[model samples]
Target: MIFGTCGQRAPSVGESAPAERRKYIEEHFRCISDCDMCGICAVYHNQDPLLVYRDYIEGTRTFEEITEEYRR
Candidate 1:
């Protein structure tokens, strides 16, 4: 898949989207540096913490599912 950012050329086909996104996050995303290992970011961000950090994955969960309890 081709990964892209605004004003940037799309990654060549056959590149890994997860790997590309992971690299971008590591270099530019600041909260990752001081993350307390708390699970809140997962719920708040609607992503799975383990998949995101350990496996460099994204879009594993949704806002409705993460905040389901609070909406009860």
Candidate 2:
């Protein structure tokens, strides 16, 4: 249950693999319907967008660093 560059399906590749490797992958960027983005995600929703904008212009942030801050 993994993907690689160009949305390629993982775990089925080698020099001897079949040429039709693309068929093994059904979709790209699957969504999790059960995810409601509550709790911690809610906190991010409240504050992180502004931080993200600041990061873009102010050159003082990164998504991973801010996300790790929220996790802590």
Candidate 2: tens digits of C-alpha lDDT, residues 1-72? 433224553333332133223222212212234447434235455543443334422334433344456555
Worst 10 residues of 1 by lDDT: 1-10
TM match of model 2 to true structure: 0.30
Top-scoring candidate (TM-score): 2
Clashing pairs in 2: none
Identify the runs in model 2 with alpha carbons over 4 angstroms from their true place: 1-41
| Predicted candidate 1 versus true structure: per-residue lDDT over 1-48, tens digit per residue | 222223343222234465664555444333443457634454437554
Which ranges in model 1 have alpha carbons more than 4 Å from their true place? 1-16, 30-56, 59-72
Per-model TM-score, in order, reads 0.25, 0.30
TM-score of 1: 0.25
- Please state every model's RMSD to the true fold in angstroms: 8.7, 12.4
